[model samples]
Target chain A: MTTLIAPVIPRSRLQRLRWTFADGGVIARGNLIHLVRNPSAILNLLLYPAVMVLLFGYVFGSAMNVAGGGDYREFLMPGMFAQTMTLGVMTTMIIVTNDAARGVTDRFRSMPISRSGVVLGRACADMVNSVLELAVLLGCGLAVGWSWHRGAGNALTALGLLLLLRFALIWVGIYLGLMLTPESASAAWMPLMPLTMLANTFVSPELMPGWMGAISEWNPLSATVAACRELFGNPGWGGDSWAAAHALPLAVAWPVALTLVFLPLSARRYRRLDR
Target chain B: MERMNSLAVVAEGVRKHYGGAPALDGFDLAVPEGTVCGLLGPNGAGKTTAVRVLTTLLRADAGRAVVAGFDVAARPAEVRYRIGLAGQNAAVDEILTGRENLEMWGRLYHLDAATARRRAGELLDRFGLAADAEKRVKHYSGGMRRRLDLAAAFVLAPSVLFLDEPTTGLDPRNRDEVWQAVRELAASGSTVLMTTQYLFEADQLAHQIAVIDAGRVIADGSPDELKSMVGGDQIDLVVRDAAGLAEAARVLAAAAGRDPVADPGARRLTAPVHDRIGALTEVVRELGERGIAVEDVALRRPTLDEVFLSLTGERTARAEEGGHGEEDRAA
Candidate 1:
């Protein structure tokens, strides 16, 4: 034990500290920058959301009556924000799976970096991507007569909530990204898109049938979509006002619970990669 | 020149099994400091498994390994901190540029911005990859990518470097380049443990050599010690007269009291003799006494291939085909 001690602090401790945050930050930033650097990724992140806004606004705007007395675009905006963040989760899975498949993750494993930092960095970057996607999608929403009647403070709170949702979904993506085989993440997890669509992103719970309406009303994503709607001045989507009263707690809880469930599981998958 | 330290790396009874088949079966090694240890084995002989254990990538099922004075299993992080591994594959990201790849690895080792940048530049220059440093690894040719991978392993200045089959797929020139780079790294006081199926690699780069077969070490020594194991020396002679083959064998056998083989088609005579000069003289005298003339006579030491063949009872070339050629059955 005495031999383990160094006259100067062993460099690895300092190195470990550097790797944990500084390196993870660099990797996270690099991954985001790499995404924006590629023209297609830029389009997928920016242009694709813009396209969704245009397509959905024209196609569904007139027929839909949002819970609130406003344009369908306004009701659709918050849900789309949640949807964008949720979609961003898949990128985390695709990128992590791709990295794992290409043996880059193994390279990181052999190095001195903290094991968790690899997935955390990617998750953080995906969160950023989700935020960007939400902002762009909202910008497009505003172009076509979507406006938030909620006060600036509440609007800011809504934006914060959207980002938080993205953050949570990033972990889910990271967890799923770490969990699924690279092949399955692309093939099997493609179904998550339809699953996302099944929720009340575009339709009202009143419009959805009995069982799905109940699912949409209580769905964790619906909770976020509802809270964002209330904050953004969209009409009431159904949630127990009792649950709505605990909105801040629920916002904090969804991410915390998902992270608690997924981060450790992601870490476990990472540890198993060593085997 | 730095004086050699005789305790560079040591492994004691290290064992690793993937599923049911044992990959490393109680393997052991000792590499003197500042010297190169070449690990030679057929595929699945546990060379890579031993490397993975030494580098702390895989835990050993049994036995102890101390690398750079850090216990591999007990103090894996410490072991990882001191050692660098260049796995069988290049392990470079095809998307990143050569310089970025090295920088990323440097960052993984926790080098600060300035240090990582500086080290990446130095490694690019050292590996002669400076020209292609800014190009994505995906664009680089195989040899360039391999050199960059080797450079990544060196950027951290680790005390113990493990190169697992460092030159598995390279042309002769590229292979020489990698070997030169490895030698330079060792010369700079990095203790290198390299595994290679190329017999000449052990003969060229290894200060010490360990021949592993069937997941166990069959031989460990300097190149000369290993060469001496099969037999210290041998004599080959050609007989001018076809009728002299039988007489040659009889005369050599009578003179040396050792079995001599006659290849009548090639008119060649071969035998293993303990004393080269004395045996040659006695054979000459006895063959003359038997009236058989020798066309040519030459003495030579055993090659490493011959040494491997003698120890494992199979040719090194054939062993490599059945051994080490199998895709790692690792989970």
Candidate 2:
């Protein structure tokens, strides 16, 4: 007979952190493996933004022009990047809901691992997926004659800001996902389209009516798009509005505020689950 | 001191409620170390709720529970480190392969990479899943998935294990395999606490059984003790001809001093008797004198099923008739 033996608990903070990371990394790998096994979904996500870029660049570009008369494709690329980052809300929501429904979250909750590992692993995997989507969209944009006139450093910063927004929205997806039952998760994606499209993703906010323009300019999506346009040296709508003038700071602030609100909310909801 | 150390799990006056109804109403249990204790109950009896509280998945509104020597409420992390739970739903990932699922659980338990891999392989082989190790769990049969879930729970061989209706949805062959696995686990020194509606399962595996009703332990004893509570041995007889049943019943009543239950279609009569061999002998002689041909007769101890029925039958019948709707509530 094999006797039961107790596991040695980590006593130091550093050791505990290491265990958290080790366990979290394994879970993140599992999420990534799902992405690999289900490539059609990834392909669809990547293709959707590229198709949008082509549709807007060619179909609508002929009649539309920037305030300063620049290439519409270049102007459209930054907005597309921002829109893609925010659209990740749907993917995150669906994945989290699927895990909760499939009993995987319950399995993770029962283990001796760190409680934060489950959400942290999921966030890590979603960020990785975001990066891949960015690469594919960037390539498609280049194929269609969109170029960043700024130097490499600013371009890199633009990409970083885009990913930061994604990181923030990921928490939003997780919170809403955890809050909703699995049956409602599919319906949850319906609101995301209007959320991304009604912003400055396809057209400049200045082109809309006065009230709609003001609201669209203040959108978190708009802030990221406007900031990325400035960083990438792409064409932008000339406006003196407070939001347009402070797009860079608002871009950082929006994501920070969202993280502050949703991260703890999702964590609390997760801990109180099954109550 | 040694005997005190042998107590693996203990709970006192645990209470939990949902929507103003008590799910675990002042429940208490104590299981000694390295032994199997079966919690027997019907639907809505709070067996699953008790498991949830002991496993640290839920907090009791009022009570104290110590599982594997750590207070469940105060030191849930410590208790979690020392116990494994296979819930009513087999909590395995459908997207991952069987081997991957086990390895994933091992990694979550903080095992190193090489050790996790080795343990996953070992568990798959042990659970008869070696051939299907690489197959996705969604592709596996229900029984295979259950075996894998059980294998995941044994990754660390924790001192105390909780199985909530482990074989509820399994076929006879799969149930036998799980029973064998649980027996082997107990023989290998793990203390098991299992909840089962199947009385035979408790009789076959549990060293001690606790019959729970209305969120409380109504009866607690070994299998034989529980059976003895129902009554003495029963004498069953079958006659060759339907017309001979009345004569057999009369002979049984005279010997057993009680009216025997007759099955007219089957031409059989059964009576509860105190003296096992004496009642069999008296009934056989009386039937022979009456010229009634007895096809079969035997004296047998009461089964756990019978004990369960006699204890819970009346209350359940009343509950059904009253239409309380309490049966729909989750445990």
Comparing to the true complex, what docking class would candidate 1 get? Answer: incorrect
B191 Cα displacement, candidate 1 (Å):
1.9
User: Please, what are the lDDT tens digits per residue for candidate 2 over residues B1-331?
Assistant: 1123679989899999988889999999999999999998877889999998998888889988899888988888888888888888788887799999999998888877788888898888878899999999989877787788888888898888888888887877788788877887788688999998766688789999998888999898897787677676678788999988887888899988989988888787878888778888888888888899877787765444455567866535323221221111110
- Per-residue lDDT tens digits for candidate 1, residues A88-176, read 67777788877766556656766666765776677677767776777788788788777788689998888887787777666677677
The models' CA-based lDDT, in order, is 0.74, 0.83
lDDT of 2 by residue, A1-275 (tens): 23233576889999888887887798889888888887687778677877888788899987887766688888889888988898888888988887776556766666687877777788889999899999999998999998888899999999999999999998899999988877787786677777787777777877888888888888999989888999999898748889899999999999999999999998888888647
Clash pairs, candidate 2, are none
- How does the DockQ of candidate 2 come out? 0.37
On the 0 to 100 scale, the lDDT of residue B69 in model 2 is 88
- Candidate 1 residue lDDT tens string, B30-73: 88888898998766678877887777777788988788887777
State each model's C-alpha RMSD to the native: 8.2, 6.2
Q: What is the lDDT of residue A188 in candidate 2?
A: 67
Candidate 1 error regions (>4 Å): A1-19, A59-70, A115-120, A205-209, A239-249, A268-275, B1-5, B42-45, B93-95, B107-112, B169-173, B200-204, B221-331
